[model samples]
Target: MSDVWTWPARIGVLLGAGLFLALLVPILVIQIRRYGTTSPARLLGAAALAVYGTALVAYTLLPLPSGDLAAWCAEYGYPTVQLRPGQIFADIRERTAGLPLGAVVRDISVLQGVFNVVLFVPWGILVRRYLGWGLLASAASALGASLLIEVVQATGVFGLIPCSYRLADVDDLVTNTVGGVLGALIAPWVLRWMPRAKTLAATRGEPRPVTVWRRWLGMAVDAVAYTTLSGLLAMAWGLVGYLGTGQVPPDTVPLWLFASVLSWVVVFVLPLATGTGESLGQRTVWLAVVPDVSRVADGGVGLSWSARLRRGLAGGALWGLLQVLSDAATMFDVGALASASNLASWFAAVLVVAVPFTAGKRGLSGRAAPYRLADAREGAGALSTHR
Candidate 1:
């Protein structure tokens, strides 16, 4: 019982909570980016799984035992195994019979029994709610999990150590399985707080709001592709400079200008070649850039090519401007001013990443221009002036 309240044990619990938060944040971002919405139930479900895993590791492996197998053999004798069932129960009964109720309740063996059952209860709830496992299946899984833990302990962590430091007890299996069953029984009441399957599938075949995450993902893909193209072009320019003047490239403004032009064409013009407005990230994440006709014309059904070109250029110019500023910021010498510039550069990067979240689905560039970014799958409906 003292071991549970020790500093090490408390740290383990804190780590488990941290793990829960760590898992939740990324999951929320991914969900918003891909689905334009998230299920709170799913996020909590994932957090529960992470906490459970952390707890499992803490109990099984933390506060490692001391002394090597050879040392133990010389001092206490060779390694041994305990295969008899009911021996723990028999010993507990014999030891507690003469003791008072308070003493019996305070015993470490009794406390361990309670801990084993409590530890596995969450597993049952998580499996039932997330994996959709039935009562019997969860119980079987609990038993299998307990068996694996016991097997590893009995084998001295599969020969890493000389002998078993922890005892492989049959009582743990019974308590853990019961805990799992108990959790499954309570899942029905707890599941009401989570999102339903229908809600999750709502955007499966419908036009969803283009989220900031989606836009950022598209930007990331485009950035990589643009950088690769820029690098090749820069190498060519450097080679030409060497051939002409027998020296390295004298000016990089041309390279930056060329890269910006290439970026604009790739982002705005190349989409025309593919016959789809989706960049690589948008394609992978099932998002598309389409014009919102209602905002484009006074009472028209679709946007003209001129409107799209203006919208594209508006967004592309800002992106190119930001890129050039970021590049220039990197060339500064190490000093207070340089640090401030770097901080501003980081702020700019953060602003770029965060703009979509604040600008709604239209994003910064689209909101600044006459075009609206929407689901590409809207097909003919996208071109109609239907708000």
Candidate 2:
């Protein structure tokens, strides 16, 4: 029994970590765009949901036979499909005959029934509370999910394996559905403090002050977006090269350089060229750059393409230079270049952190440009009219 749980627990943790990392940027972007700010509770809930999903799969269908599938099935005598309803009660009674009520409750057969129900409780809670489903809908969803799991088990993962390794019991379906209903009933109390998605969406258009934390979050989003874009471009480049030449390109330096430049163009340059004056990350976090009227000669109204480009370059020049140096150092394996890149990286990080504390709340980028960051909810016309 302990072994049964230990393996599943390990699998759940490993898969959960990978799932969390993969979903982190998407979650952050969604929350910021929908809510106009990040919610700690929502983030935590998302992380919990990921873990629960992995654990559910781990517990229900894991620890498959490593070798000699037919021999293993014969030796272990895998159970057949259990179609009888209320079979759990009979199993419990038979296993704990002549025992006290407490002993019966504690018996392995009874505990198994309880565990099946408990395993799906999180599904009910998440669907009802996080998903905002009605009780009936939540219960039905649980039934469907449980039925699917049972079908998969009975079919040996849809016939991938030769035989079912776990029992597909009708009693489990009943208990799991009951657990879902119970969870739906308790969901309100369990998630009373969680913010409603509707409320967040309704206020998403309202203007918010540009704060240090908001700026930092926008920067973080940009970094993640850039990194993701660069990786994707590199992969595509390699794939194309492999298909055309029958082998992947030998030197990755050119691919890396191309990907980095293209990613920068998409993430930063395109937005400025289009006159939005916002990076992908800034847009996700509801921020935009508007011309600072005091410094602009044209009264800061409807910034021209040249002006926008200038602002973007002013803001990103130093960091962009540092990033190029870093990339060069990495690609060429030069000790002096690597040391310079490291120092520049650290300096850039310090500037990002420290400049936010200043009176303007603009980082070095903002200070360098004749533009200031404003909440996207504040229309460009309104921001341009101000300092």
Candidate 3:
């Protein structure tokens, strides 16, 4: 059946289109090498390509209104800047209203199960083929993935990633697990029924393919790229202000300083989120403070919404207050415009800023998600060798 094309569908189509087009070259090569590129095989090959292409195009054309949904939620102040745990459940209840009722229709209408089961068909294909995990493992992975998408929407997009937003509700978890099972059960047949097609499902490498620390290091490299970009922006701003103003304005200098400090928070620091806001940096570099060895065995970082909130409040409040004090001190001037008291206060504030980086477990980097990255190349290098 043809799909109702939407903007997201178009984007999804474009992404897969390049790969599908690439597949055409392989068919020609396979035909030339094996047979004389004759009528039946060529026709069959062309038919297979057409079917695969149709499935992909149709999948891309589906009316998955994710962006519109997010915008709609945003219009209602759903993801408020500040939030609480209860609101999380409230959102679940609300989003639950329009959930696809495929499971409910299974008794009388088998066709409905097609829609219900098909909704998460990829989850099964992913787990069984790529992840090579069992039913529970597949369910857990799906739950984690779905919860993460919600959390990112809440925290990064909406800025309302509250405890509930960060959490996977019991209802949603069960529903999502069931959806995953449905998908898995339906996947083998989906592949079989795909009209003379050979589709290889791929996944984000985890087990024997890529080690955790290596992935962690790659994340660190991305952080460095972000930092470098921030630095270049700062440099350009300084040059532009100097050229336009004829002389660097007094305010221009301070803005640069502030940008320099804050840029660290935006780029290198935000990636280390451990569901509870204890970043990878804090977990590894400041391991003495966050004590996240348990997260390692759990196989992922950041789970509990409460933990994230606590870490964010404690770390953020402490860090923000300290930096503000520094700003105040930096701007302060004595009666003579050169008071020793002011100078001393500024120095004291500067020293105080280091307190978080040295706090309990010294998980106090307060630099946000950047701790592990800053230290791994230096500290963990010697430590990792023993492993």
The prediction achieving the highest lDDT against the true structure is: 2
TM-score pick, better of 1 and 3: 1
lDDT (Cα atoms) of all candidates against the true structure: 0.63, 0.77, 0.42
Candidate 1 lDDT, 1-387, residue by residue in tens: 365545445655678679876554456556655545566667777766776677676786555546676686356432555567656677778778889999998777787677788878877888777767778898888888888887777676776766665777777777788888888889768776866444666665566667666576566555555556767776788898899999987555666566555665665456633543444445545565555554655654344566555544444334544554554444333243344435445543754655556444655556644555556556665534434
Please, what are the lDDT tens digits per residue for candidate 3 over residues 1-387? 333424444544565555555554444334322331212434343544344344433442222234444564455423333234344345444545555676433322333324423444566555644334666677677666555544553454345322222222344334445677775666556544332222211211111212233233332333344446556766676678789988654534466455544554554346434233434333222221222433344434333444444444444333333443444444453234344335435543543454434422223333332222222223434434322
Give the higher-lDDT candidate: 1 or 2.
2
User: What is the Å distance of residue 371 in model 3 from its true position?
Assistant: 54
Give me candidate 3's TM-score against the actual structure.
0.28
Residue 327, candidate 2: C-alpha displacement in angstroms: 4.7
Q: Stretches of candidate 2 above 4 Å error? A: 1-3, 6-18, 67-70, 77-79, 243-246, 252-254, 297-299, 302-344
* CA-RMSD of model 3: 22.3
lDDT order of candidates, best first?
2, 1, 3
Residue 309 lDDT, candidate 2, scale 0-100: 58
Q: Where in model 1 is the C-alpha error above 4 Å?
A: 5-13, 20-26, 29-36, 65-78, 196-199, 210-286, 292-360, 367-370, 376-379, 382-387
Candidate 2: worst 10 consecutive residues by lDDT? 313-322
